[model samples]
Target: MAEIYRVAVHYGNDNGFVEYNLETKTIKVDLAHDEKRREAEEYLAKEHTIAVAQDGIRDFKDQKVNAAQDVESFKLALTRMWEAIDLHVDWSRPA
Candidate 1:
């Protein structure tokens, strides 16, 4: 059977948010807007800035952002990254 992989984001204190990589399954903290969470992915893709990240994270963040056109394609890529992490991060989980 296939796996359950998706990008899941939950609210935190003071507008803070936690993002799951769904690919490497790793999570990163973005203090910026919702888009920033996805844009930061450029670091994963090795892009120069968030502009090109849209082409990568388009479907994930917005239909626009980087110079690329297709957005949904990017979102599609996040599925794997989103599944790698634990998703829920409250530091309250049993250790």
Candidate 2:
């Protein structure tokens, strides 16, 4: 059996859950029983995204910024810092 990745997006009175079958590259969505839940879930999802972005920013600030002697060295250091930040984040969504 192939592994499945499940993502649940909650709304006010209901929820919409999505399942991705990695092996088959198939997607399935299970929506909430009522419309209210959808709204709540959407709001919560937005909030979660914001929080994740904030956390990512914080993590990025903690990375070491190397002192470079010239423009080329500075660019290299900046690239390395960004790469480090990327590795530090376990991105559930874009952050």
How would you encode candidate 2's per-residue C-alpha lDDT over 1-95 as one tens digit per residue?
87765545333434455444566544444555544434323322221211112355455333332222233322333233223322111125321
lDDT (Cα) of model 1: 0.36
TM-score of 1: 0.24
> How big is the positional error of residue 22 in model 1, measured in Å on the Cα after superposition?
21
lDDT of 1 by residue, 28-69 (tens): 454445554554454334312222234454534333222122
Clash count for each candidate, listed in order shown: 12, 11
| lDDT for each candidate structure | 0.36, 0.36
Q: Give the CA lDDT, 0 to 100, for residue 83 in model 2.
A: 37
